[model samples]
Target: MQNLQAKGLSALVAISILFAGTGCQSNSASATPPESSKTLDTAPATAAPAELPIISERAPTPMGEESVRGAPADPSAGTALAQLETIAIKGRAPKTGYDRDVFGQGWKDLDRNGCDARNDILNRDLTNTVHKPGTHRCVVASGVLADPFTATTIHFVRGNATSTAVQIDHVVPLSDAWQKGAQQLVPEQREAFGNDPLNLLATDGPTNGAKSDGDAATWLPPNKSFRCEYVAIQTAVKAKYGLWMTQAEHDAIQRILTSSCPDQPVPTDEGGVAVPIAAEPAPVPETVQDTPTAPVPGPVSGPDVVYKNCTAVRSAGVAPIRVGDPGWDTKFDRDGDGVGCE
Candidate 1:
């Protein structure tokens, strides 16, 4: 009987030990966090912002545009568009005309005012344009200016090294203004057109040349981000100068400003000639598609449009590029790479 009791006691102890072991196993599993939680704890952190944009003197920007949040509708176009019609383009669009030297014009100042309009503009735009050593008037230390031509910065150094990299851009290209009725301006108004500080800026040379005689209808900035503001400023300048726009050009500028920055107030001639957004037929969103270039006759029919060759390309409608001429080089061979149809 005593031995039976001892066996019973041994069995009880075994059962207790088994229960304790099971309890420990369950506790161990419970102590482990969830698999999902473990994953979250091991995840990596987020990234940082990029460096500031670089500023070059005359070269094209290697750094591209960043997306900008859109703005609201500009409200200055209505009256101004009407005003443009009332205010005729003063200059004549010549079938034949004189070169730059021929404007038997005003101010009668050869140096264009003892101080050229360019130096004056640099003084206005630059933070601190250093003057000539002796003259105390010429820009000797024009700092890096935001060149509107390429939408890049151009730093102008003084005295010794003059940068043709910089140019005085006529806010309204001389030719465009002429076509829009600048020829009718009285000598005084014409002089103002030629010399207005408001109408000129120190810009990148190549881009200035690229802009050449283009109007809103014909061309716009390559940098997509700056287009709206460009159009706005152009609108204001034309409005200020009493320049008229063709139906298409008017529509195009309106479309760009309205679509890109519906929020940015249409710049006004207010506060001294803000470019107003024109309220027109309709607005179109800007796209990367090839802008319809002024009509080019393709052998009267083939993909080949535009008569190419350096001089022809640079001087669009200004010179001798009549149809059926062999001199027509349409490859748009800007760099003169032997390949045509580029």
Candidate 2:
């Protein structure tokens, strides 16, 4: 009886040992996590933040003078449609205190090319150009303009009566700019804005007149094919000058760009923002004892000194010849302000 009882105890001990070994193996397997659980355990603590909203792309709220001053140097680097996205949309400002003189007396030689902005654009946009004989090609005597606004071929003759046939149209008109953000620009910047060739185009005079002070919402080139380029040019100008657009204007430009010419590139050119340098005032000469000298002859009056044109007059060191001065002719006084070639 004692031997049998001992055998049962031994069998029970063996079974317990086997069960313990199986539990040890199971615990070893569980010590290393399953592949799926391992992946979950090693995963990043947090997801990447969601992309910032599109609202961040807009100009700062309450766009101020600094906004106008922060124009990009090369606003034409991108597609016009994409560039339009960067411009601010705002209501037009009051037109008070706005005048042609607010920009400058007239076209300036901002490029310092020895020619005014008017002639520069004329030379640039016109074909078969004929420059004045002695003007070093500074003065455009005549040219043929493929007028974009009217989609017509127009002859441009530089004369008081005929010059108006082809006029330089401001892609973004001065008044429109003033009402937009130009009111915040300094005088020099305003002058630069007025003369920027990127904003100027040679177009049909009557058509330009019809587009006076009008934005894309109000004016578009009559030629349907040119509208895309026209809007693109306007967008480029506004972007270049840090000028804002009205919501209507923005919408109009957006519609044209998206619907018609999605790939339209901003017209990039050598012509850029050219601010005119102010001429330094001549230093005051030291006073000295007067020496006996011959009386300087006053400007010759009447037609005795006949000048073919203003170029000849300037060459003779007698520009701005007054109405009664020699070589003075009504033809030379384009503005008819009694001053010829002033």
Candidate 3:
């Protein structure tokens, strides 16, 4: 009975050992990690940023003095459209007698501003302009042109070959003006129309060629952004000179101006301050006073006389009036030759 009790105690001890070992193995296998750990190497993926627009470093300033239509319209588009509306709608006239000379000698100092129209426009439109040597700022030697027609930067150097590359364009081409209403204008009016800075622009040569005599209907600036301003200028020129437009030309202009630039102001007097037209001297009243039997003329002084300063002479009429001509006076002769108003 003592031997049997000892064996039974040993078996109980072995079973207890086996149960403890199984519990330890199960605990080790089932253990879990803590939730508050930092194992990530990078942030999650996201969409890329958008691209920006292209902007020119040499963009031109919007010049107020260059406004050709005088005081700005409250809504430039309405004023421009109203002006455009006034233009008579008609078919293009025949180009039969459209001689360039009909407008008068090209490039007159019509404004009497010392510089010819070409140089005046160049100085107005170009940046960093260098004047021709000895020309006293009357001629452009070199400059940077922010060409409106092509929206490109051109380095302008004055020479026969290079000069043509920067030609002066008539915004309202002379031929177009002639057909519209310029045929009815007198010689002086024609000259004014031709050299009016409002009508002219210094533009890219190739572009000008492509746009020869084309109204707004046929051509527009290749630079899409510049089309509104270009159309505005054309409308202003047509308005100033009483020129008309074709059905297609009117429609095209209205589309651009009314839709795009309805508030675009007419450019004032080309690029300069506007000058008021001078009143003509009261027509010399016919004199019925009796002439002396003997020669009674001493420098020819009377209500019948019309002597004016040199500026008035140049502004009112052409230059180089001779000593005995209708409007000549010895006072205007700078060189004191037989010619008085040269």
Task: Give the winner by lDDT.
Answer: 2
User: Per-residue lDDT for 1-342 in model 2, tens only?
Assistant: 999999999999999999999999899888988888988899778888899754212122111112111134454487899999999887776665666657877678776767777777777777677877886776778878878877888987877567767877888888788877777777787889888888888888778766756788878888898998888888888887777887888999999999999988777645645544435422222222222222324555555778887656755656545556667778776543344543
TM-score on alpha carbons, each prediction: 0.50, 0.60, 0.59
What are the per-residue Cα lDDT tens digits for candidate 1 across 1-342? 999999999999999999999999899878876788766777675567778776333221112211111223345555333333443322234423323322223112222334444455555455435565575454345466766557686777643124545666666676566555555554445555666545666666567657766777677878678776666666656667666655666777767756666544444431122333433422222222224445433333345645545334334442322223344453332212121221
TM-score of 1: 0.50
- For model 3 the local lDDT of residue 322 reads 47
Greater TM-score among 1 and 3 belongs to 3
- In candidate 2, residue 320 scores what lDDT? 49
User: Between the candidate structures 1 and 3, which one is better when assessed by lDDT?
Assistant: 3
RMSD of 1: 14.1
Residue-by-residue lDDT tens digits, candidate 3, 75-110: 534566677888888776655466555776547777
How would the candidate models be sorted by TM-score, starting from the highest? 2, 3, 1
Clashes of 1: 25
